[model samples]
Target chain A: MKLIKIFSFLLVLILFSNCHREDFLQHNRESVKSITGTWKIINAVRNGTDLTDRFDFSRFKITFSDSSYIVDNSVPFIVTQNGTYHLDDPQYPFKIYFETPDNFTKELDFKYPTTNGVRNIVLTFSPGCSSNSYTYTFQKIN
Target chain B: MRKSLNYIKRKISWQLTIVCAITALVIAACSITIDSIDQSDSINGGETMQSTLHVTISTNAEEDNSRLMVAVLVPKVWNARNNASISFTSSITDGTQKMTAVPVGTAAPQGNGLDWPTLINNKIGHGGNLLPGWEWAAFYSDNAYNVGGNINLSVTVNIKIKTSQDNISFKLGYVVAESVDGLSNSQYYNSAFPGCFRVFGTGDLIDFCNPQLSTVDPLNSLDNDIVTLNFDGGIIDNALANQSNIFLCAKGITTDGDTLNLCRQDSTTQLISQGIKKWSIDIWPRGFFNLPADKQLASIQYYFTDATGNVKVGSTGDGSTPFTYTFKCQ
Candidate 1:
């Protein structure tokens, strides 16, 4: 009887662990779906200074379709850049890794906030130079 | 009865051993499957994957001339492995015929001995280590006068990277120069006389056969010594321009407060190569040797000027100002 009880306990533990792994994977997949879309830069701040008038922020558009992304900038000149991006986690504090066409790999954190029934994406870039930081607030257009 | 009981115990032990073996095998198979699944997930993980090879071309304006220079730059992580090498083959096409490009060496302060013309024939990093962010350059000379007049020059380069694990090839094209004027106007001191001073033994005539100075300073020169000042006109097309208009002048101040004119030559007959002219002057340092002892030679200046007095070439100060070289008299 004692041997039968031990076998039963081990079987239950294995099933519970398998279910937990599946739950974690499903959570990650669902998180990735929420962050995929076309986002337009509505506001930009650099080094505690606003640079909307100095730069044409409205001309910048980042489109995300499935796993790949492309950035189109037409302010001073029309330039299109394509790259691949990945999410480190599907939950809060989302870290997005980008690999540029020029062979540069970088990571940026993204925040998803909903204000007044509108979803917004915010990205900050601190380029390891001085105390300068660039914050880009994007609105989901599509 | 005792023998049967012993046989039954042995059978039970065998069954237990077989069960344990099967369980261990199942556990090992499960671990391998889990690891494979993790690897697959990581690859498909929402991230951008990149190709192994990347190449780019950047241009910089030459300070002395109007010609533009193109440099090939490679990323730091592209070739991070042992026994790795890269081969670059570049050519210039002018819509008619293709010609091989002459690999230009880096400018002064970085030592002229580090030129890449000799290394361009083989793999760049063979038998040596190639660090990240290294650059190699080539320049377009207007040698072909037939394909002249505001023509577009295309520099097509083929790069091959070989490693122990894999080999990759990249073909890159760049428009190095457009509307290039066929007339070349530039000059530099001959590489043989690096710093504009050549020393020789006492009573030794200027050896044209071996122009390269054996030493920067001749410790054996007596009171009266003759030294040759050799200058090569670099890329300057003196054939098209007036030959008599090009001349070089050297001036020195004696230790006795008197100005001494060493040597001046206006002859353009010495042809180093096609379109390249040579000017040489032999100077006897009477004032330099007249110094008591161990006094340094000062205020020795030389310059090349055109008929219009516009400094065409010199060793110092934007090639317009006079170039000076000083050394202690032995």
Candidate 2:
């Protein structure tokens, strides 16, 4: 009887020691939103008319890197020259500021909307005449 | 595949027949037919432009407290809302009936919650005007009458629009419908596009009626924007119309009254042929003129030329005049 009790206790101890460990659930924190990297024109409009097919905006690109920016094929953009750009608010951006090398800053209203599960940065500006307003939607390429 | 295609065609025929029969029924219920429209080809600015609309309405359904509706498509610059008046004489009415501007925001019956002007605009469209800046002006009879069932009535609408002194050419359109049916059904309304009208006032001709040899897209542009200068040689005979190779000769006027001329007949200024005598060049004013970073352009005056710089074309389709495009934000 003594031997049997000793064997039972050893089996229980071995079973408990060999059992797998339970993992505690961990929460995944949200990532910081960004507008960096190269963006190309995904869609464009003029005076409420879709100009995507009417005009060739395929080569237009605006690359954003930290504070400074550059333009590839210039369309009627906010700033014509190579300039610095920043969001009004990083967390809840409503506007963007583009400052030229000469310190000429042009404030532009922008909307960041996700289209078809992809983020798009929309900018509206009147390059030629005030009556002709153009909205350009950009999507990140790299 | 052939058997399947034949079966599809048979099914489509039956469906089309049914759709046509239903359309006929709807049209027979309440329909307006515009018989004619009489508008002047041209009128002097600051004067009143008169027009007339002849229509017939046949209805098998009774509508109570319904008013006659008339709408006009005109240039926004005309400000036709406050400058126009209308009166109608119908076969059923004893005397001439007065019409007042449909108060802004007055909802049209059966228009799915849209106002009379909005509904008319959405339904009628711009009457084939190519450029922007046009609107529809809608008016309603001052008094509503109980239109009897199974009755056919004829109406003659007289319209007068006081003009603004802007030398412009535009297409004129007229529509006739009743307040009861609105523009809900194509059969419920009728329209007449009487063709282009002209207001000879002052300033450069805003020709919307005919085609031009040299035209600019976006009608407005800035140095930073890519402006397309279109040369349509097919429409009219010009010096460079028969030439296959056309080049651009342009002069950019700076903000400070400096001119940058690029009149070379090289590949840099050559226009891309879109086949069929249509040539176009998309140019960035800043780059094309080699404009410095500090300098800005106020406008550009340009003309089309052929190889060897001998043949040239300008605003005057015959190459006598140069076309000027102003860079403006307004």
Candidate 3:
């Protein structure tokens, strides 16, 4: 009887610990790898407009690390912006979202809406933004 | 007994295998059923309209007791009493004359007709609405104050300012004085600059040739702001004052003069091929880098400064002219 009791107790403990282990591991599957290096903008499509010739992003750079990111559009009139970002996968084709210092959040589910990948990628201005949404498509220019 | 032991061992092994299989199934199922976290709504429409950025740029380098004595007279001449106040102590030396130095924090004798002009009198906006490179201060020393006098003069002035929600502003200001003393008998006053630029490369320090000064000052309507002395492709002859140790300097007619200097250099191959220059120093009374480049020349930088001394202001990290630069080679 004592041996039976010990086995039963051990079985219960194992079951309890394993209950949520799988779920937690699954939730963190997309974030185990480092996504803070550089990303190249393959192509962008925005709002039925082809605005690719508007800027040059060949020498651009997108740097993300330590909860901050800098998108330096390496061109004249450098359209550089820096803030915090979030993602579902934190990897290639990562679902990216933008946040500002004042806590304004904007999502870039994919790329742009106007110009296809031919134009430089631009992060568009979102709904309720008083300023015109400018789209910026960029490949990581490391 | 042996038969019973075998039965028990078989049961335990079966139980363990069953548990492991269940665990794998649960893990695979959990991974498939995972929900993506919503990170998009965290920062939407969050910024409130920001109040204007308020700031007053002043130098702490010249705030000794002797300097305060001289500063007291600045308000008298500039008539800035209503906009600000000036005070000094009898213990401080009057840098201009042999008068007994006043104590710290004592108010100076107001000059006849001394009073701060109304903000309207200033063409520049108030509450921090001034342009980025403008500085204004009303100074009153007996006008006889000269350098190297027993009375050393330093300055500190405060002005109200404001900023926009994004912490960016259309205006800025600083406290500075005008003296006719940059190089003997040369009066330094603020003049309008079209803009200013910053240039610095690795070439500044470890040069293959002799040392030379490069500038990035942009003066409005004056070709003098865009000055350059090239030492490349030829032997710099010292007989011609042609040594690469070229020195450049500019003095403003007022406090509006701006200064820029090259701070660093980086070189690389085709992977990262463009040059990246960082702004290293700003000597304007009101510090700013609003000047745009008039021309882009390969192997060179275009910018301006009031005088050559301004370029070297922060060379030793003294922070007097506080700025730095970076250069990228690829």
Candidate 4:
């Protein structure tokens, strides 16, 4: 009787562990990796000067989902109006683009770095002159 | 035995630390100094300006064969990399020596992977110029010369730049270093500032040397940019000086000849006081003017106002001509 009871417990544990692994694998295979989230600016720089504390960038936020993007409180950004977006290489992106409704696209130098256990998106572009470059760093508003 | 000598200095990077052997011209480590700098205080736009810098270099070794490097910091509008010419003459070499532009990405030796311009600008400051845009154009001697191991030499570098047709006041700076040291430390290079220079031309004066009553943080930007407008109530006696609250009244003229009025005395257009009678406000042109996505700006003409928006102050402090910011790129 004791041997039968031990054998039944092991069988149930094996079934539960196997079912959990299968569910995890199935979820991973079905979902595509994306940068779909509401992101807010945490830092800003003009040329080489840090303007994070000097200027007010608290109201700016960007939301990216699949192929669509929306901007709130637009600053000097890649595009004033956004309709769609894309990465130069989604897996290892070096550039990102904001595509307006009319298909007018603006490309910006893109950088993704993990810091302090948090991932960030850094975009650099010159809104006015190429001599004056601006960098904006964004973090997911989770 | 070693001897350290003092020479005329126009900047900190130009300070030469000369250590010499007692009996002969043997340099344990050769140092550099700028004895004198000759440049004009004023140059007219659309013309070529010529300047000469006299430098002294102590040779590290007779076998130290390296190209001499020189760089100049100038406004981007001049496009010094394309329009400027740099050459030098030395006691150890023949009449005129040729120098060519150091290619864009050539890393400076001993610079820890920094390029010549970046290394120089980081080590040497902006020569007291206040404006944001400055370009450092570096050059290298066409040929390498091992003049001698035991030698002290004097060099004169001639610089000629074709001034752009914009009225500008800039504090000119220069740096001299060899290919080997590459501005690794202060001992490796010498830098100098000739002083404030001005080019008399058209448009409003883009003065980098002096303060202004009303100035923009970035003198160049488009309607899509976040621009900071600054007003110095202390610099001039304006009508709104007594009021604690200052506002911005601006008219943004679009590229399509449409004028957008953004003048209001509410919270949005209020300038933050930075004390000492200084006031500034950062505004996004697109959002400030409430423009449609397709519209673009040509220029913005603005003025400072009081609480009721009655008292106004412009470039002339009395609203004669509005302070204007024109969109431009180079």
Give each model's whole-structure lDDT: 0.40, 0.82, 0.31, 0.82
Please give the fraction of native interface contacts (Cα pairs under 8 Å between A and B) kept by each candidate. 0.00, 0.60, 0.00, 0.67
Please write out the lDDT profile of model 3 over residues B47-151, one tens digit for every residue: 221111111112222322222211111111112233333332222334222212223233322322222222212332232322211223334333332233223
Error of 3 at B191 (Å): 65
Clashes of each: 2, 3, 95, 4
Model 4 segments more than 4 A misplaced: A1-32, A53-59, B1-47, B58-63, B94-96, B100-124, B149-152, B180-190, B237-243
Residue pairs with backbone overlap in model 1: A86-B46, A86-B47
Stretches of candidate 2 exceeding 4 Å from the true structure: A1-32, A47-73, A81-109, A114-118, B1-28, B34-56, B64-71, B76-147, B151-166, B178-186, B220-225, B266-268, B292-299, B316-320, B326-330
Q: Which ten residues in a row have the lowest lDDT in candidate 1 chain B?
A: B30-39
Task: Name the weakest run of 10 consecutive residues (lDDT summed) in model 3 chain B.
Answer: B30-39
lDDT tens digits by residue: candidate 2, A30-88: 34458889999988877676767645577778889988898885456666678888888
Off by over 4 Å in 3: A1-34, A40-46, A73-81, A88-107, A110-137, B1-330
Tens digits of per-residue lDDT for model 1 on B1-330? 999999999999999999999876443221000001001111111122121112122222222232322222222112312112222222233342222333345431222344432232132231121211222333333333322322232333232222111111112111222113211111110011011111222222222222321111121222233333445454344221344445555566544555555333334211122233544443334332344334434445666555444444554323556555442321
Q: Write the per-residue lDDT of candidate 1 for residues A1-142, one digit (tens) a residue.
A: 9999999999999888778667877766644336678888777665455655444456567887766788874421111357877777755547777777777767777677878888888888742222235677889887
Q: Per-residue lDDT for B191 in model 3?
A: 15
DockQ of 2: 0.32
lDDT (tens digit, per residue) of candidate 2 on B139-201: 989999988878889999999998877777899888888887788788889988888898998
Predicted candidate 4: interface RMSD? 1.8
Residue pairs that clash (backbone atoms under 3 angstroms), model 4: B13-B191, B61-B149, B62-B148, B62-B149
* Recovered native contacts, candidate 3: 0.00
